[model samples]
Target: EFIIESRDIVGNQRVIGDDAFVVEVEGPSKPQVSVQDRDDGTYLVSYNVQRTGTYHVRVSLDGHQIAGSPFTAQFHPGLVMAVRCTGVGRGLTRAYAGENARFTIESRDTHRNKTTSGKKPFVVTIRGILQVQVHALEGDNGEFHYSYRTPRAGVYFVGVLLDGVDIGGSPFKLTVDPGPAHANGCSASGAGITGGYTMVETFFTIYSRDYYGNQRTTGGDVFSVEIGGTASADMRMRDNENGTYSVAYTPMIGGDYFISVMMDGVHIQGSPFNIASDPMPRESYLEMYRSMEPTFKEKMEKMLLGGDVTGVKDRKKANSRRGKEAAQQKSWVLNIKLLDANRLIPKDTTVDGTYGTGLVQSSDPYVVFTMGSESVRSTTVLKDLNPTWNEEMKLPVENRLEKLKVEVMDEDLQDEDDSMGTAQVSLTDLVIGVPKMVTVKLKELNEV
Candidate 1:
């Protein structure tokens, strides 16, 4: 039933008299409808549906359709047979590998009554990354179970068949997660060149192990390095041929550097190590400068004017050039609004072969705006297909020809975040002082 109020031209509620209103319903078999006049500027419409289909109910004022008319309603036949995982009466269900899962199929007649007297033999089958064994419970009606550990990780299909016909909610899907990483007995510490001079090389060591405390000899594990200081460093890691790994750090300028190490995307023990380096001696600094060829000095000077300084140079000239370059750089104020998305792939996977449902299945989307090496990100919009985020940012643009890259990613808890799509906008065409609204069409990563 729909409640519609009529209003006059001046926005006052108007009473629709009995003679002024008419109601008609069009459906599959032309359901009989009755109209009752309440005499208080209101009318009641009642209809008995005889068929299962869509119906269009139109309300007219006098001989014309009202402001809001022709509403649609759909009806389905009464519930027939329903099937679900034993413990789960309805909706989605999940189970882990090597665990027992039971399914219960409930049968109901057309009269909306449950009956098991004429139950037929039901077939249950499991298929996916790997097939598992499924068997019917002995002496149980419409009950079956499956127990088997999958060797691989992926989605699995569970199907229930009654009299060779698929029942309601057949071919249920489940997901399987990768096996545990067994990262229990790992250790990391500073091993070499705890302190050094600028441009000098230093190193550290990390010992990786599994949950059993046995050293991991395999080389598939990944390690990352992060350095924090005014000046950056060249950092890389190398396997020491033993179970331990060696990380090399070469300081670019003299200062204190904080080093952080991560294994398998997690921080290692005793991370954020501090290493101190002294400035190069005057003699050493001069020797490095003199080692350059005569023509190379001019190239070096040109690079230093652009903030790429290696050797010590005239401070006054370098500062003056830097000031000029800073003045020429443009700063942009951006008002970003993340509107919505369409046709996004599901990223959540489980060991039971069930993908996420409802909000869990939707993406926790966030936008990352990048220009050259500088990047800023908007706050995450949780579990929505049409997320609205009106955020603004101010950033300096060093290169006018560089395109602004926008990447949409889905945040995950168990693994690496997944990229949904990306878009690019050319900044050179945008007016400096004017704010322009742009609708970026997100495309797959490989799409140009």
Candidate 2:
């Protein structure tokens, strides 16, 4: 049996037997509806309405109009401005007659509204009489473009049409200059270290411009920089954290090194500067651990409270019990690895120096850990000093530590004492190379 089922209106919600839903509308005037009928009876239909006007969208049942809405189609007017006939060839006053010219269209409309089929149609027109063919853009944001050719080399007017109406008469000009031309320029600025280059790391300031004296820094184009040949990388001038780019390069030679800066893949021609790197002093690291020795012994004493042997050899028996308890409470351990080959290091006796490969020979010898793209906190959790290499390092969060970095620095000698140097290192001071990075993704511990 066929039922009207409360009637259906175009663009309105429709609920079918229990849970299914559908929206129905009358087809547009120019194109008929593209509908597909299911064996169960629901029809999947689609169509497009070309121009702006009030039209009826009818829902039908066996060729009879059951329900409908008066759908209104309107156009929105907005502005699209562009410089016409931009030169494209290597040399130019203007490009050749048939050559393809490139130009940028600056479209501005704070209110983002559809332009083609609203209540009011958007009107468009251009000056120059240059004979051109134009077409509407098919993308989401309403766009229209045109192509033209110089017929007899005289001035011309380009006109725009919208909803069969012409827009404001004045048009953008395209001066066809005869040519043999070229263009070029450069950029430069002062660069100095701020903060401690070793402990705090630093940034450099640079002011740059282009060949035509155009401020390239404001152009938002990215700039690439490479420090010492081995430690090379690229960065955008605009992406600098504070009007400066930060890169860390360890100068093995300890002298002035030249830095190369390139913009838009083309070297800025004359933007190279000499950066001085002082020699890194001898260094050593010390890590301490909070052993659970006493806590374990106290727990053993509590267990013996209920049981008693009247004369259980007081001193010797108590000592053995305390030792057993201390062993059981040892859960977390901390360790520090002393790395020094190029320089000598005095042992912390608590930390074992594993004479491993790159031990002291490489500047980046410390164990570094990172989360995705961000640095995580690192802390010393255990220390063991034996001829054997055995120690443990804890995660920073475990100790309620605010920072994740630890470094050893000594100026007078190759090794520094535990109390002589600083313990907390801020992650911000370290600039990691391009390929190496850390990123952290924390799942919400509990949903509010």
Candidate 3:
């Protein structure tokens, strides 16, 4: 606060009118100033300071300098003013999954003094498609360090907490990008053709991707299809532009046909799929019942005689039936271990007009085991590229030929979970009553 007094030329004090005097102030930052005219020929001047610096206050009466003319005042560091993220890599708002992301923060007081003395724990959290844990680098001062890795792709909110309260701009947003393409397999599916005439059109779809789960959208010219057997079909392939392809063909003859698909010179899984150009004729229910009567009668007689009625006269048929029943009755024990992943495909999604790409540094990964229609999931491993879960499970194999599907997925809260990779193992390849330590290499969606 500043005060000023006025006097008349006759040495008598005079009252200063509001318009008779003017005050001007200059500082490093904009300052709020106010003045009041007193009835006793005095003036009161006040101003609010924002930053620490020297201020110049000038007084003038009727366009002439007052006794003091100009006054100078200095302000030192005061209370905490604002905290912000600063320094190198401070505002890095984007990163790839499995890649490290870092940022630094600094706090200052109103007087522009660095407040780096206390041990005020800085709490940091990331929330988005998934929730992740963030750790500050050792040492806590006005300057702080934060780092994290996200496994899934999506927008994430990075929040910083000081003294259990959020500072200005507490939460920062970042985009995560999935990594480079590493599609390792392909899958094919479509509508089956039944007894169609010559020149009848049928179509199938194929999906291709890398081992890291990245889809293949371009360079699809390498995809090829071959139809063998009785059907001589003209095949044409079309790129769907979304990591998939459509193959449309017209059959020239009626009979059985074998369709083989290849991508990048490698045969995909389930290649050489068999299809019928001409649908097989259906048998009447009465005729089928009549044909089974002799076998039914033989089984009924054996049952009444207290013999094994499930046995069949044909040795091959009996063996096949017994194998199926045994598979259904016996439970297989499997010990699965999720060791690690190599060059995993990054996953990503968009949120709030921002594109988030890349994989999180430490992916919270889990595994799901699927056989037939039943599925079981393993416990999640947080923030680890190489997760280990040596777990044992007992499952009933209803079909000996059914493949056991193992899918690796990352856990997320805000959106659908992401898949890392998948591998299929046949029960026939395992030895019963023996524990096999199998290393199942994961593959992308369309990878073989």
Candidate 4:
């Protein structure tokens, strides 16, 4: 609607109407228009268009164009047609988590015509873990641009509203992907790193997170871990595919170890973790070194020779408990046609100080064989109750009907060797040329 006032050549307002006024609208479609004279030389023009487009409104007086002859006007749909609004941008498809997301909206009517008037009243929202805030701006043109952001990744529903009404695509499905893992957000955990024991299989776990402190759901995150110091060794990593990884490593030699965890060539939350691994127990040396070599005695000798001893130490004794367990054990493999003294009674008592600190319960025991007219004695074993003396001992056998006597005795450092027990064997009916294995019962021996 518009009002026009007539004037005289002297620029004075006219008191009464004089000339005829003409109003015409030119556009793609026709519209309802009307002109009214107010009797005071003023005219009123009102027009309403059906469709939306650019139109020219012309005003003329007495077959001649007025001072401002024509005016350009744009017709847009009303705000009631918000459901016809359309949105377009990359944010509608996918977005990167912890980053800005943007898109544009074109306000339209039922016929999809651009709108130029209204309060807008646009409400944009994204359904995510966090309450996202949206910012909308009106461009110089009739387009509406909206932006929003969130730190979480997932399939989120986005809504665009205008005047309390949903837009064409109100619930936009937006897929968010996790960003790269951040150093400060990644962390490590587990027994291998915090509560590690030497010469034992230990493992740890690593968790990966993004810059926004959100856990990544998928794998493909690369990491580098290195163990250093006296317990240095290679660490193995297993990807759990859920932002967590398992790291495995064994401390061959116990001491201090430094564990470094890195993600994407950068240090994680607690990189270079320090841990002190305690040495393995003294009794477990056999089990620990058995896998190191094929033969049991070779592994023991190697461990003993390398001074890889653990547990308590007493620098004064000429024969330590460990030396007694390994050296005096005499655990050799037995060959055919040989007399093998496998093991005897244990020497070390449960109480400490096997070197005689007032207690003399255990002893050093050996095997003695009385064959023919001569008697022979093997070396004595110290404190280890479970001894190994596998060997091949050959003696002259003159009489096949003669009996052989075998005895076990404990050596007394201050007196004569005491007899623990004795086994009596008689070879009177033995077969010649063929090797013979005799079994005998000891007279005074209980199972050790």
By TM-score, the best candidate is: 4
Which 10 consecutive positions of candidate 1 have the poorest summed lDDT? 83-92
Ranking by TM-score: 4, 3, 1, 2
Candidate 3 local lDDT, 55-108, one digit each (tens): 888888788877777888887655554463333353347766656788776666
lDDT for model 4 comes to: 0.67
Report how far residue 220 has shifted in candidate 1, in Å: 23
lDDT of 2 by residue, 1-448 (tens): 1122432445444544332323344333354555554434355556555433444455545555444423443434354322211212221123333334432222323232224322223333323434443333332234333334342232333433334533333233344322111112344433232112222233344434334333221223455777643333333233432222334433444455566766666665454666665433321000111222445434433444435433334633665565345333433122323221122133333221321112221111123333223332222322211111122344322222235443332222355423212234333222222111222221221000
lDDT of 4 by residue, 1-448 (tens): 9988888777787768755888999997787789888889898889878677799998888788778779899876654477788889998768888788888888777767777665466788876556678887656345888787888886677888776777887777677888788987888766566756665667776878888776676788888888898946756778866677778887788788899898778899878898887765555554344234335544464455455333213321323444344432333222223222323443334442322224434667677777666566677667533333544465555443456677777777777877767876765333222223343444433222
TM-score of each: 0.31, 0.22, 0.39, 0.48
Tens digit of lDDT per residue, candidate 1, span 251-364? 888888787777666766666577787765554433343335656655645554355444435744554465456334765444444433444555553342243332345667
Worst 10 residues of 2 by lDDT: 283-292
TM-score between candidate 4 and the true structure: 0.48
Show model 4 residue runs off by greater than 4 Å: 1-80, 116-119, 282-294, 297-448
Candidate 2, superposed: residue stretches over 4 Å from native: 1-248, 263-266, 279-400, 403-448
lDDT of 2 at 326: 38
What candidate 3 gets wrong by more than 4 Å, as runs, is 1-21, 27-30, 35-44, 50-55, 61-121, 128-130, 133-147, 154-157, 167-181, 185-204, 208-234, 239-243, 249-448
Indicate whether candidate 2 or candidate 4 has the larger TM-score: 4
Query: What stretches of model 1 exceed 4 Å from their correct place?
Result: 1-92, 106-120, 139-142, 151-154, 175-181, 184-314, 318-448
